[model samples]
Target: MKKITVLIVLASFFSCTSTKIIVDRPIVFNDEREALTLEYLENRYGLVQNTPTIVPKMIVLHWTVIPTFEKSFEAFDNPTLPNWRPEIKDISGLNVSSQFMIDRDGTIYRLLPETTMARHVIGLNHCAIGIENVGGTEKLPLTKAQLKSNIWLVRYLKDKYDIDYLIGHYEYTLFENHPLWLERDDGYRTKKTDPGQYFMQKVRDAVSDLNFKPLPNED
Candidate 1:
């Protein structure tokens, strides 16, 4: 009887403290953008699924170079790539997006479904979930609230998925030779430095008990 009472109290405590996630799904243009996403998955990632859903095996953290959450949302809200990124226009007009975005205040927003593939990471997009935090520049650094939120979010995702890895955007290159690295064009990679090294270390430390696989050593 005492154990049952303790369990009930613990459940109530968790329910009260659970993080709230706002669903603000982006405009997923189905015409050419969706088609291109499908083709990219198939041709680049060797995924042959009929839909864009993914069996997420990893979580990749990022920092939006943009300063404000509103501006960041505006950029990803569109399905077509804005004209500024003309280099990859031929590949697809589809804009880059993440499954979740965290504001400076630690407000969590869902930009896409958990299983849906988003074009945030380069090679592992087919099997990874992306988390984008606003403001990564020197003038506007990430916040403690954001860090707390990230820890909570990562814990939530780990509980829900069979996630095997957690890495920063900068660490994606380390997986180039791994089976998950499947970009067809070796030269198509973009330089990334997001959610900084220190930030990732903090997050990893907070969730170390989860025992996620360490980033592969660079060969």
Candidate 2:
């Protein structure tokens, strides 16, 4: 019975994969938040959709830079932006979040539904799923365990959806000219360097066989 229960849960959203996803959906997605997401999509992406869902074309990797899993989760669990993030508050109150969060120990936590539009990225939030790692500072770089888990999670998501590109948060700007790029305000961009280069290379190499499409500016 226990085995059957687990299988049922997996069948709902994901395909058969070794990656264990722990659902810790503390981020509020009530009527107000949903309304805000819809407004963001229409205003930012020029998409007047009745829902705030995405088609899942890309997978974005990020590092929280917060040094601990609890603090990182708290940062995103709120419905609206906190006071410190005034730099981006002028854009939208919808707090930044991701579909998945990986702890330093490689424990995978699902913060929101995979198709929900998270404000983690600027130009591609309409169609990209974000994966946030717990720590990304130079003093607390992403761990080996997190790397292994990210590789597995990437493959699992690729097989489950029509994912075409895998990218680190820093590389999102490269898609500015691509058709999938949808941010209306060109000047509303912020620099990012999360889930660093070495970490990205390792994960990409692990899933090399998946043949994800190249970035728009990749040489």
Candidate 3:
């Protein structure tokens, strides 16, 4: 139960600014995970670095699709992919993870350090910070509380970093050949629909004042 507290100034739904909290419920990022991260960075992004770190330029949001917070947490807590996820296991044993995760009740949890490189997105893991939500299946759509929390996180990260983009998981493919896309394998892409359009749009609208750069299709 190691924890670190962060106090962020958030824009309330009614346009007033208030302080909000982000809890640090860390997952296992031991020596083994760090080694995998470094190897993945070098092999995937052509970055041969001694330490696995990323200068975040974007924020990508995702939904767990696995109902409970504990289950979703467990999924990303490991350093290697589990046996059940055979489709992506061979791609590199590094498990998928995000820097932040939100529970259905709008509880924001930090799964990893914001600056660390996480294997959440396809091509932009080298420069994007990820935020995952607890639920987004047809059985359990993302909740309003989650939307508000996401909006808050987007603003917080934008203020803390030089973030140039805010995107949903599905929009990741749009950056395929753009300057930031760094995946060497052209065929290593996968279709995604986590944290759907409506949810993304709501979060976008709430933080529209931030003026994040347009997605590839928007221009």
Each prediction's Cα lDDT score? 0.82, 0.86, 0.89
Model 2 residue 46 distance off true place after TM-score fit, in angstroms: 0.8
Residue 133 lDDT in model 3?
97
**Candidate 3 TM-score versus the reference:** 0.94
TM-score of 1: 0.87
Residues forming the 10-long window of minimal summed lDDT in candidate 1: 2-11
What are the root-mean-square deviations of the candidates from the true structure over C-alphas? 7.3, 4.3, 2.0
Winner by TM-score between candidate 3 and candidate 1: 3
Best by lDDT, which number? 3
Which stretches of candidate 3 lie above 4 Å from their native place?
A: 1-15, 217-219
lDDT score for residue 141 of model 2: 89
TM-scores for all predictions: 0.87, 0.91, 0.94
Residue 100 displacement in candidate 3 (angstroms): 0.4
Pairs of residues clashing in candidate 2: none
State in Å the error of residue 208, model 3: 1.0
How do the candidates rank by TM-score, highest first?
3, 2, 1
| lDDT string, candidate 3, 1-219, tens digits | 656676555544446686778888888899999999999998888999988899999999999998999999999999998999887777789888999999999999999999988999988999999999998999899998999889888988888899999999999989987999999998888889988999999989988988899988555
Better-scoring candidate (lDDT), 1 or 2 = 2
- List, residue by residue over 1-219, the lDDT tens digit for candidate 2: 111111112322233435365656457788888888998999889999888999999999999999898899889878888999999998988888999899999887777789989899998999999999998888998999999778878877887999999999999999989999999897998898877899999999888888999889876
